[model samples]
Target: MTGAVESPFWTFVKQSVKSLFIVAFALSATSYTDDVVGSFEGLETGLSAALNTSTATTPKTTYEALDQSLGKGLDLIKICTENADAAGFNIGTAIGWLIAAAVIAFGTTLVTVIGGAVLIVSKFALAVMFAVGPLFIMLLLFPITARLFDSWFSQVLNFTLTIVILAVVMAMATTAYDAFIASVDLNSNSGESPMWAAVEIGALTGVLVWIILQISHMATGLAGGMSMAAMGIRHLMSPVTGGLSAARTAGNIINPVSTRRDLESGMMASGTRFDHMIAGNTVINPAYRQHVMQNIGKNWGWQKGGSVKN
Candidate 1:
C-alpha cells in the first residue's frame, strides 16, 4: 500500500521553516553590506587624516594633502631659485646658479606631476570599485561566481594600498625638501658652489620617481599573491565546484568521446612526441631523432652516415 500522505500541518511547518531561513539570510546580508560600506568609508577617512599635509586645515582629504605637498615642493623650488639669484654672484656664476635651479625645478615638477596623476587615477578607480562593490558582494551567494567578487575585492585593496604608499612617499619627499631648504646657506663663501646643493636636490627628486615605481610594482605583486591565496582557500572550501569535479567537467567538454589513450595518441601524431621524453620515457619519433642526430654530427664535424669525425 502507498504511504500516507504527508500531513498538512507538517507541510505548513516546513514552509514556515523555509521562510524563516530566507528572512534570516536577508537580514544577515543586509547587515554585512552595511558593515562593508561603513568600513570602506572609514578607511577612506582614515587615509585622508593620516596623509593630511596641511596644519591649518581640519578634515582634509588625501587628494588635498597630496596637492598641498606638491604645492610646497614647487614653492621650495621657487625659494631655491630666488636664493640663487639673490646671492649677487658675477654673470658667469649667476648663469651656473640659474642652470642648477632649472634642473632642480624640472626634476621636482616631473616627479610630482606624474605621481599626482597616478594617485588621482587610483583614487578614481577605487571610488568606482566601491560604488559597484555591493553587486560583487551579492555574487558571493553563488559559489560559481564568487571569484568575481574575490577579484573585485583584491583590486579595491590594491588601489587603496597603492594610494597610501604613494601618499607616504610624497609626504616623505616634502619633509626632505623642507630639510634641504632649511639647511641651505646662500651666503657661505667656503669655496663650495651652491650648485652642488641644487644637484643633490635634483638627484633626490629623481630618486622619488624610482621609489614611486617600486611602490607600484610592490602593490601589484602583493595583490597577485593575495588573490592567489584567496583562490586557493576558495577552492578548498568548494571541492565539488573547484577540484576533480571541475577537471572532469572540463575534460568532458573538451573531449567528450575520447579516452586518455586516444588523446595521447592524437598528441603524438601531431608531433608532440617530445612529451614522452619529458615524461622520462626513452620514446622518440624516428624522423625527429634522425634530424637531431644529423644536426649534432654536422655541428661536431662528423660524417652524417656515422659518428666518425670528418
Candidate 2:
C-alpha cells in the first residue's frame, strides 16, 4: 500500500461531507418565503403612504377634488345668474355659463378616464407580482432559475415605482385645482370683474388638462422602455435555443433504429444534402456525412436555391 496520510476511502468520505456542508450553507443563504413576502408587503405599504392615499397631508384625491369642484362651481354660477336676472338682463351670463359648463364636462371626462386607466394598470402589475411570488421562492433552490427571475422582479418593481410617480403628479394637479377655486372665490369677494374671472378659469383649466396629459405621456414612455428592455434580454438569450434543439437531436440519435428513418427523411425534406442511400449496411453504418449533417444543423439552416443561412 502507498504511504499516504489518509486512505482513499477516508479521503472520499471527507470530501463528501465537505460538499454536503457547502450545499447546506448555500441553502441557508437564500431568503425564506416569509422574508420575501414581508419585503413585498413593506414595499406596498411604503408606496401607498407616499402616494397620499388617505394620508394626513391630503385627505382628498385628485378625482374627488375634481368632482367636488364641478358641483360647487355649478352652484355658485346658478346663484350669480339668479342675482343677475333680478338686477337686469342676464343673456351674457347665460352664454358664459354654457361655455364654462362645456369646458367642465370635457375636463371631467378626460381626467376620470385617464386616472382610472392608471389605477387599473398599477393594480394589475401588483397582482401579477403577488401571483409570481411563490415562483420566486421556489427558484431559490436553483441559482440559474433565480437569475432568470431577477430581471422580471426588477421590471415589476419599476412599474410600482412609476405608479408612485404618477400619484405625485396627480397630487400636483389637485393642488392646482384648489388654487383655481381660491382664485375664483377671491374674484367673487372683490369687484367681481367678469373678464378677469373668465381669464383665470381658462388658464386654470388649461394647466390642469396639460398636467393630466403629461402624466399619461410619461407613464406610456416608461412602459415602452420596459418592453424594449425585455425584448433585448430575449434576443440575448435566443442563442441557447439552438443548443436545446441540438440536445434533442442527440437524444434521437441515441436510439437511431427507432428514430433513424424519421430523422433522415426530415433532413432530406428540408433540402439537406444526404449523399448515400442504403437500407441494410448503409443505414446501420454511422456515415461521415451524417456527422457532418449534424454539425451543419447545429450552426446553419437550409434555405431556398440550395443555400444555407447562419
Candidate 3:
C-alpha cells in the first residue's frame, strides 16, 4: 500500500527535472537570435539619449540612415534579401541543435511512457499534454519547408526591428505631443484649432496602441516558454499509464485503451498552446510593421510640414 502511494510521487519529481532541461535547450536553440535583437534595442536606447547628449553629432549619419530606411520609400521585402546570419546561430547550427534536442526529448519520453503506462491518472493526461510542442517544431523545420523556417525566423527578426522603429516613432510623437500641449494655454486663450491638440491626442494614442501590441507579443513568447517547461516536467514525472498510447487518438484514453506513439507522442500530446501563441505573433509581422510604418509615414509628412494636411 505504501509502495503504491510513494510510487507516483517519485515519478512527478522525476518529470519536473526534465522540464528544466527543455527551457535550457530552447534557449540554446535561439541563442544568437537574441543578440541580434538586443543590438537593435541598444541602438534604440542610444537614440533616446542622443538628443540630450553631445554624441548626437557623431550619430547624425546613423540617424540619417535610420530615418531613410524606416520612412516612406521603405520596401518591406528588402529585409529578407539582405538578411544577416542569424545573430548567434548560423541557420545550420540552430537547425542541427534544435533537431537533435527534439529527437532526444521525444525518444526519451516515448520510452518512459510506453514502459510506465499503467501508473497514474495524471500521467495519462500529462503524456498527452507533453507531446504538443516538439511536434510543432518538427513540422516547422521539416526539410521541404525548412527554408520557410528562415523566412519565419526573419519575420520574427523583422518584428524585433519594428519594435525599434516603433520606439523611434513614439519618441517623435511624444516630442510633438508635448510641444503641442505646451504651446496651447487652454486657460489663457480661447478655443483655437484643436488640430495640434488632436495631434497630441493622436500621438499619445498611437504610443498606447503600440505598447499594447508589443506587450501581447512578449506575453505570447512567455507562454511558449512556460509550456515547454511544463511539458518537459510532466513527461519526467508520469512515466507509466496503463494504455495503448496517449500521443495519438488511441493513446489518449490510456489504460486498456492506448499507448504513446513515439517519443514525440510521449513528450507532447498537443502543441503547447502557449508556445504556439508566441510563435503565431511576431513583432515584425506585416500587421505590426504596417501599423507603425503608416503612423510614422503620416508623422514624417507632418513633421516635414509641421502642420496637418488633408
lDDT values of the candidates? 0.63, 0.52, 0.36
Positional deviation of 197 in candidate 1, in angstroms? 1.8
Shift in Å, residue 149, candidate 2: 1.7
lDDT of 1: 0.63
Evaluate model 2: give its TM-score: 0.46
* For model 1, the run of ten residues with the poorest summed lDDT: 258-267
- Provide the lDDT at 102 for model 2: 49
lDDT score at residue 112, model 2, on the 0-100 scale: 49
Across 2-59, the per-residue lDDT of candidate 3 in tens digits comes to 4644554444444445444434433444532354334444644564455333334222
Strongest candidate by TM-score: 1
Q: Write the per-residue lDDT of candidate 1 for residues 78-176, one digit (tens) a residue.
A: 655675676675776676667766777787778767787888888789888877776776665555886777788788877877877776777677677
Residue 91, candidate 3: how far off, in angstroms? Answer: 68
Cα displacement (angstroms), candidate 1, residue 110, comes to 1.5
* Per-residue C-alpha lDDT of model 2 across residues 1-310, encoded as one tens digit per residue: 4665465544444445544533443344344234554565566557656667564545254345445545544554554454444434556755554455445545545654665566567668777875665555445345456554555556566556556555565665556566666666422235554545556655665665566556545655665456444443234334554565576577557634322333444442221123233332234456634754666657466554765589
Q: After superposition, how far is residue 125 of candidate 2 from its true place, in Å?
A: 2.3
Rank candidates by lDDT, best first: 1, 2, 3
Better of 1 and 2 by TM-score: 1
Candidates 2 and 3: which is better by lDDT? 2
